[model samples]
Target: MERIDRRLGLLFALPVSAILAGAFLAPLLVVAIFSTMPQKVFDFLHWPDFSSYRVILEQGYWRSILWSLGLAFTATALLLVICWPLAYGMARVFGRFTLVLTVLVVMSLFVSENIRLFGWFLTLMKGGLIEGHLRAWFGQGFEGLLFNVPAILFGLVYVYLPFMLFPLAQGIAMVPDDARAAAFDLGASRWQVFTQIELPLAAPGIMVGSLLTFVLSAGAIAEAKLLGGRAVIVIADDIETAFTFAQNWPLGSALSMVLIAVVGTLVILGLRRVDLDAIMGRRR
Candidate 1:
């Protein structure tokens, strides 16, 4: 029976694995090959000169890379702070209210992301909703909020809130209420209980949430472009410009490869805290 079950599992997994490889891995493989080739090459099979990487160094594109990393880090940290309390409420305190909150968050995703962002644009742009109303009512209005770093960060936080919230709630839910009560009974302060007991137990969920938020924020272009008004050019912008505007496949591929390398390393590190077997209900 065990052997039959194992075989069935493999059989079921084969098609999904094949689809992943073809649909996901194939393009990555192509980009990897292209990254090694010389510039302006129509074929990825061209000789491996690695000149595109040189252009990245010589042309000083590190600013965009730094901007991308900084924004992503900031956004991820902010989401962690913002979601922790809400997630805790949803996981432990809300009871029946959790369903309502989850539905609201999920419903937001049903709208096009661009449309939602554009709505913010209309509100934050100069002489737009907030400013116009404030000026009309009180004769007090600042120079709009969009086209700034803070606005981009706000967009990142808004868009990725659900990603962080659900994972954190799941993580916090896994923490036993009895354990928290026991800690309180033992005269442990709230801060001590949180740091020593709650945080360690919730590490897996926190890691997953932070990793997702960081990687997505790092690669995001729409926030910077739409909300920031090009106040900052992120690494994704550089890659897109290379590929589309500059028509430089090798350079774009190289930039992409760098991003993949950076994000992949962090993902691997973050994933170390998570237990897949436990998550899958197969823990020994």
Candidate 2:
């Protein structure tokens, strides 16, 4: 009976597992194989010379990678600071407004990201929405805020705001009210309570949110391209160029493998420290 049940469970799991493997694992496998091929070659007949991997450094792709990592780190840090108070309020203090705020944030997701970004592009452009209105009404105007590093960062923050906010609120919600009350009863200051009780208890969510925002921002090309005016060519942009215009699939695959390794290592190291039971609200 136990064997039959095990077999039945495997049968049920097989289809989804196969689908996931085909959709995800297969692509990574292909990239891994291609990464070893010589540059500009398409077939698998050649020896695995790892020439493309060397090309990453030879062609100065490392700079793009560094830029990507730096921007992703900055964006993630900013999101943490910006979202913490709001997430705390939503999880602990907003009351009726919580639903209102959640709805507003989620509404933004339904609109296409490119459309929203293009909206910002129009609004920030010189003599555009905000500037144009001010110039008309108040006779004051400013240069376009688009096509700069700050604009790129702003776009990153704006696009990924909900990603950071929701996870953080979920994390803060896991902190029991009794804990905060007890801390206060024991004469803990607000700062002390936050640092000692709230922050630690809510850490799992914070980590997840940070990881998510970092990964998304790291791979983001659209924000830099559309908003940044190609001032910074990110790793993703380089990969895209390699695959599309450059028509160098092996180099693109090599870049991809490196990115996957770095991000995957970070994720593995992060998940190792997170307590699943705590995040899931399990007693154990």
Candidate 3:
């Protein structure tokens, strides 16, 4: 019976594994191969090398790479500030109210990012809802505020906030009420309980949330392209330009390879503190 069950499990997993390879790993391998070749030699039969990476590092590409990193890190930091308390509030409360609120938050994630950005565009432009309110309250000096970095930041936060909240809610929910009671019973102040007990316990969730938010925001081209216009250029946009307009597949592939390397390094560092295997529930 055990052997049959094992065979059945492998059978079910085979298609999924094949799909993942074709969809993800195969493309990545192709990209890696292309990144090492010259643009003229598009043939996969050619040998690969590091010439593409040399060009990437020795050009103006670094600026866009830095900008993408900055934007992603900033958005992730802002998300932690905004979503932690919101997640805590949702998790702390009981009843249908929490259910309704959770549904709303999840619904925001359902809306396409482009649609959300367009909605914000109308809201934040001059003579729009936000502008009208600002003019009425803070006066007319608030002009030219929405079409730049602020808009990009807002879009990023709005899109990725749910990713931050869900993990945090899970972490906070895992904190037993009895544990809180025991901490309080041991003469721990509210702040102490939160800082020393609650936050420490929830660290893994926060780390995961930050990682997701940062990576998504880093690779985000639509938000920056639409909201930021040409005022701000991100690495992903640069890659798109290389692939589409510049027709420089090797350079674009190289940039993507660099991004993959950076993200992999960060994930390795993050996994040091958090039990990644446990977090991913792979323990037998």
Candidate 4:
């Protein structure tokens, strides 16, 4: 019976495995191959060269790369700080009110991300909603709110907050109520209970959420384009420019592969703390 079940599982997984290989892995392989080939060449038969990678190392690409890393790290840190309290409240303190908040969070996911970003764009634009109101009331408003670093950061946080919040809430929810009670019974203060017990137990969620948020933020092109304008340039923007405007396939592929490596490393690190069974809701 177990053998039959195993066979069935494998059979069911075949389609998904094939799809991943064909759609994802195959393309990644192509990109890797292209990254090694001569610039502007689409043919895979060309001899591999390290010139593209050397160009990346020698050129001003570091500025965009560093900017991407800095933005991603900053956004991830801010997200953790913002989401931790909210997630804890939703998981433990909010009780019945948590249901409404959860529904709202999930509903936000149903809306198109681009539409939400565009809404932010409108609100931040000069003489737009917030700026117009502020100017009316105070006779002064932030003229540089749109097309700046803060706008990009705000957009990233708004879009990715729910991603961090969900995992954090889930992790916090898994902490037993009895554990908190026991901590209190042992004369631990609320802060101690949260810092030592809740936060430690929620490490898996923190790792996973940080990984997701950071990688997504680093690879974001739309947010930078729409909100940052020409003031900010991230690695994703550089990659897009190389692929589209520059028409340098090898350079673009090299940049993409670097991003893939960074994201992949983060995923591996997060997997160390993540409970796969808990995430998947699978039986051990």
Clash statistics: count for each candidate: 0, 0, 0, 0
**If both were scored by TM-score, which would come out higher, candidate 1 or candidate 2?**
2
Winning candidate number (lDDT): 2
Model 2 C-alpha lDDT per residue in residues 69-117, reported as the tens digit of each score? 9999999999999999999999989999999999999999999999999
Inter-residue clash pairs, candidate 3: none
TM-score of each: 0.93, 0.95, 0.88, 0.91
The predicted structure with the larger TM-score, 1 or 3, is: 1
Q: What TM-score would you give candidate 2 relative to the actual structure?
A: 0.95
* lDDT score, candidate 3: 0.83
For TM-score, the strongest prediction is 2
Cα lDDT of model 2 overall? 0.92
List the candidates ranked by TM-score, beginning with the highest.
2, 1, 4, 3
Ranking by lDDT: 2, 1, 4, 3
Clashing pairs in 1: none
* Per-candidate alpha-carbon RMSD to the true structure: 2.1, 1.4, 2.9, 2.3
Candidate 2 lDDT for residue 233: 89
Cα RMSD of predicted structure 1? 2.1
lDDT: the better of candidates 1 and 4: 1
Q: Name the 10 consecutive residues with the lowest summed lDDT in model 4.
A: 275-284
lDDT of 1: 0.92
Colliding pairs, model 4? none
**What tens-digit string does per-residue lDDT give for candidate 3 at 1-284?**
99999999999999999999999999999888889887645667767766778887788788888889999999999999998888888778755677888899888878888998878877777777787887888877456446588788888998888899888876776677888889999999999999988888778778888888988998998888777775688999998988888887888899999988887788778868885554454443
